[model samples]
Target: MKYDMTLTEKQNLTAYLISIATITIGGSVYNFAISYFLLNETGSALYFSINLAISSITFLIITPFSGVLTDFLNRRNIIIYGEFILMLSILLLFIVTYFYGLSLFSIYIVTFIRSLFNAIVNNAFSASVSNMFHIDNLQKVLGLSSSIQSSATFLGPILGGLLFGISSFELVLFIFLLLSLISFLFDYSINFELFKKENISNNFITDSKINYFKKFLDEIKSGFKYLVSVPILSTVIFVGVFINFFNAGDMVLPEKMMINVLDFSPIQVGIVNGIMACGTVVAGIYLANTKKIENHLNVMRWGFIICAFITILIPIPIYLEKHFQFNFLYLSTILFVKFFVLALINVPFIRIIHEETEDYMKGRVFSGLGVISSAIIPIAFILYGFIYDLGFYFLPNIISAVIIILLSIIYFNPKKFI
Candidate 1:
């Protein structure tokens, strides 16, 4: 695949990239700030995970309709509106924080609204990526995109930690608001042509039919059939779903260990996550320059194996600290490698989705994948929270390792699925 692009395509892509990076940074900081605040104040992973679960479950449900929205509406407008709503919501939350301290219920309410907007913006932006770049350069562009995003993902927590450590959480929220507004401006720069294959005349009326419940359901069904039509793509989506579900243990358990077992402060946790992002940045730049890996499945398969090993070993640092008096940042070390491998493994998967699906179908494919991937995060989050409350912190890691290893050995054999 040739990597060359027209000047206009280049500009649009650049604008889109900057826009997404800004918003992602804001979102990441918000997540870290809140997690640290809740964990510190309540000292309960259960409450924090419950809030997270509610948001995730709502996000899962909204995603299907969101896909229909992305396909039916102007994709750019959908992105723009989504950001504005999120920024507004954060502003309101900031106001609430200043006037009255946030209760658990207030947090859940805000999380619910944020999830709706996030489902729209995230799904639309990802779908747009498929449309914006050339196929030859798609993987490399995706890698570069991941690298840009890694800065937001990894550094957000550190920024959040520092902001929270030195100042108030509201300050972080204010910064998030500013970022969102700027992100929307960047997003507005690109133009879209989603009607490449469809009729242009009277298109507005035809697309409006999607507003009806029946038409909406029909559209959602079409997206599903499209995904199932491709065996490898279908398998990939299923694998992603299972990975997300089982990996919930890793998400919660590690933070729990870091907080209680490793005795790391939020700033330290942020630093570890930031370091992990740095690794991803390096991996991403390499992928951006290198040609695509011919066998992306194998790359992802090995990723599972590497993460499985790390999952099993996650609890060891705490053991060492308690028994052997080792003082290394164990969680940070494992996460660094984990995110680096993730950049390799995930960027390719995204490229495949873009390569496999058509533009009109991009909405359903991305949204469907999102729905399934998020289907059980609530359950996983809440269940893991209970596991932590019961002092089975390391047990979840053991379970996750076994699940991942078994999946890698059995499920990853292409002969079975492909």
Candidate 2:
């Protein structure tokens, strides 16, 4: 099938894919190292909760500005700057570990810095993609991007786990820094002029320089106003938010399950996650190649339904571990199945978001979505941590699944909103 993308478009897309893969590998490594380090050192759920809360707040506070900056500045330059900042933060992590010793507070500070840079870079990157690709092709590109990210997730942990096993945390941090530096070079090498268009005045930024926080608040208001004015877009955002809410458990539960229920070593946990990443890679490629499916809304609805149903089966490993005895192959199979279903839904959903949004609005819209989606993650993490502490693992998954199903029904029903 002819995909209707030009040679230049293909080149740009390929560059983006490469860049994403590079950065995602670094991100995955950092995530693995920080979580592992924090859990081992502090051994305090409160510290984890605190770190998450600080990072979430930082993201929320900076996202609006990041969106505005994407609109106001050269997005390519913004991304390069963000990468440099990330590199510095990673280096600081290494310094802290190697010289000052591993302090939880210092680690939390680095995490906050890392998350802030992530917010900026992500907004700029999304905006750049929206500008470079036509709407019809957006979904395919997003699918491919998701696949790349998932593949990185699969490999990054294995590398991180191995490195952590042999070397100190400082070594892992140094590797992260090196990867970020490489990503920066990639960002620098890209020709921004290739994607440049006439800069239209973003009325939102006229007063932004005068009072940054006030402007941020107004930009956020404008974003919400835009959403409200566009019912279809608003509905889409709401649906996306609900979907994220349900899937939030997937992020936290699997690690906890691996450690607590399955009693797997860190390496084994990484392997299982790597297998799940393989599933996501496959799903991403499939979605990228598939021709336009009829009724995207229907596809999305069914995707969420599938995800909800699959989530119900997530407890199978735990159940088997308890009753049927610990079987490595069985647990891995169950986890892989769960991740496979999630990837199936996630790729399509990502495509929809990329396809549906307009270029000018993409940054703000995505930032808004990020705010809503991630706003609750810290809370969910804390809640899940408490539940685990209370010896209740299955309830959170069940509740999340049911909530997703209900939200999907509401989101898919045209009569409800339209």
Candidate 3:
């Protein structure tokens, strides 16, 4: 019943990072393997797209409540239990696949449930970051977390592809199950309550059923109110929505161009994607080693602007493929720069939000931010998918670049921050 507050700040941060790294690695590999499995099983791009949309839809529907849960419930238990449930779900899937069979409906259901828990766990972890470590170490932790994530992204597809090619789908699921167990152990080691706020602790224990329901609604409303009350925060949310809509190309265009247009082998495509993720890794390292940024907003603003310019070059390889042999080097260089700039934009923005928001409000504020910023993404993905189907591979990048440039011009000014 006692809290584990024995670990020092450095130890806590290390445990937290290792925990995140393990989960991300497993999740990434599972994602890659599942995508391929679904495509091979269904042989329908439409079904694949629908499967993709499930996560976003789940985020929109469940994320609002998840924010409240993180704030009101025990954060450490939320993370630990959420992760446990995720692992259990996947284990169940593995057992079913091994004994009876795996159904598409089951896949969709598990994906939805896992997505819901992921939102809760992610909100808790993000909201707890400021409480877990000193404010001075916040950037370092964020930076290192980003590095872990980007490294996972880089490794997942390659490893997943190798495993899938050599092993069965059930085996991949079991591997992920094992990885999740490892992550759980690391997560259990963290003393999330070490810096816990007294009044915030055990919030749900004191509330009656009816009072808790009403209080949850009020908390959500207050979170939204606080988000809009801050001019820069609201502006950042708007900009996030705009950029994310266009940035959907980051997920779609790369595959469409590399695999569909340029006739890249699976290995070639993986290499290019890995190279882009490496750019993010480098940027994360740079941020982790640096001192506090005085004008994070300015840094973010220019980062977006630079990324927009880099995005415009994404389709050049496609255009030149008709005349000469398609060299991935050119496209890789462009993506490396683009991803690097994106990391710069993202890390500072997250740090700003964490630094500005009060501890009690961080969960809801971040959840509200997640909802608004992501609301446009599914639509954007559909639009880009439709456009790519029409053989307009270059159109998405051009459209994204122009819109991001215009939005940055209008919204991302130094004066706005002042």
Candidate 4:
């Protein structure tokens, strides 16, 4: 795992990776158990959807401001305090679950609080990345981090199902609490300021003697101003919002078709999901082994194109439904390639943002991008869900692919986008 890093650098990297991994794994397990737990308790999918919405809606509301806070505040403190709060929250949940069992209201409240802090911590961590490691190793670190996260996400649900099957809900919470503590300790050991550059302006302060709230507002305005000023950066972000909306088809249609259209079993659906996640992990590992990417926009555009082409092929197996094994294999193969290409799009897009934006502006820009990108996902999901319900099972992918291909061509002007 050692590249050209020094001992201290390596230690910091390890601590950061471990911290993120533990947090993700714990969260994944908690999420899986909580969803089914809520449904079983209430016998309603509405509660589960509400729980999911709480997280997403909280992120939408908090993320933009979190970005400003990330740039203004001591990032290290933000992360540490955020993790500490998460640990305390989980501890509280553990106690509540053990004494009184779980209530829907209590669960909702905890989810909101967790989402709020997660938004802040995620923004701070993302904005801190460029300052966390050497430029030469930036892509490598990002790739490795992506793989770590993808792996945690892949494993968390499987582990959650296993644990939740045999153990008490309180035990699951207790285990998550322990992992949270481990993550907090690892985060504490990281030196977030070690690689920070000098003379970067602190947007939270001003010689105009303004109040803190006024300064914060001014900083946010400046951040947006800077974001629009960079043609390439903002353009790519806009493209991301556009692409991500259409990308929801990939999320919605596959499982829906496998079950509703072809009548796949639980085991078959689970295997398909495992294949999708494995694609992401494999792509991340591939990127990590490479040194750098040239022409990030080009790579991302091609990735999108390839994914769109694959998306059109996803419904082909429906015609061959008589052959169960063939249908499964075809769907699995295409979905794997789709996710692999999707993963390819992410690292370069991030690298582009890192390279193009000013160091001081990263938090706001990233946060702004986050807000823009995330807001569209739920909307996309709703639209795709509606289309699917309308008996347009195959239209979603085909239409989405056509739109992507057209957008790619329309925005293919190098001078404007690159």
In order of appearance, the predictions have TM-scores of 0.82, 0.83, 0.89, 0.95
Candidate-wise lDDT, in order: 0.77, 0.73, 0.80, 0.84
Q: Residue 90: error of model 3 in Å? A: 2.1
Candidate 1 residue pairs in backbone clash: none
Query: How many times do residue backbones clash in model 1?
Result: 0
Candidate 1 global CA lDDT score: 0.77
Ranked by TM-score from best down, the candidates are 4, 3, 2, 1
Worst 10 residues of 1 by lDDT: 194-203
- Give the clash count for each candidate: 0, 0, 0, 0
Candidate 2 stretches greater than 4 Å from native: 41-50, 92-106, 168-170, 191-200, 203-210, 250-269, 316-337, 384-402, 414-418
Off by over 4 Å in 1: 32-54, 90-110, 161-174, 194-211, 265-267, 318-330, 383-402, 413-418
Residues 1-418 of candidate 4: C-alpha lDDT, one tens digit per residue: 4349777778888998898799889999999889879888799999998998899999998988898888777898999999899889888988988899888988998999999999999899988887887766777788888888888998998999999999988888988999999999998898787677763865345556668777767777787788888887877788777987888877888888888988899989999888988888888899889858867777877888887888788777765556788888888888888888888888888887888887778889999888888877779988988888787766778889998887765664465653
Task: Please say which candidate is ahead in TM-score: 1 or 4.
Answer: 4
Runs of candidate 4 with Cα error greater than 4 angstroms are: 1-3, 203-214, 412-418
Better of 2 and 3 by lDDT: 3
Q: In candidate 3, what are the lDDT values of residues 1-418, reduced to their tens digit?
A: 2122334877887888887787788888899887887888778888778877898788788888888887777788999999899888998899888998878887888898898899888889888887787666677778888988899867877788889999888888988898899889988888786666664455455655658767778878888998888887788876777787788777777788887778888878877888888888998898888776767777877788787777677777776655323468877788888888888888778877877777777888889988886677767877988887887766667778888888887887877666
Task: Write model 2 residue lDDT over 136-191, tens digit each, in one string.
Answer: 67668767887888888777877787888888888887877777777777667665
Give the range of the ten consecutive residues with the poorest summed lDDT in model 4.
198-207
Top-lDDT candidate index: 4
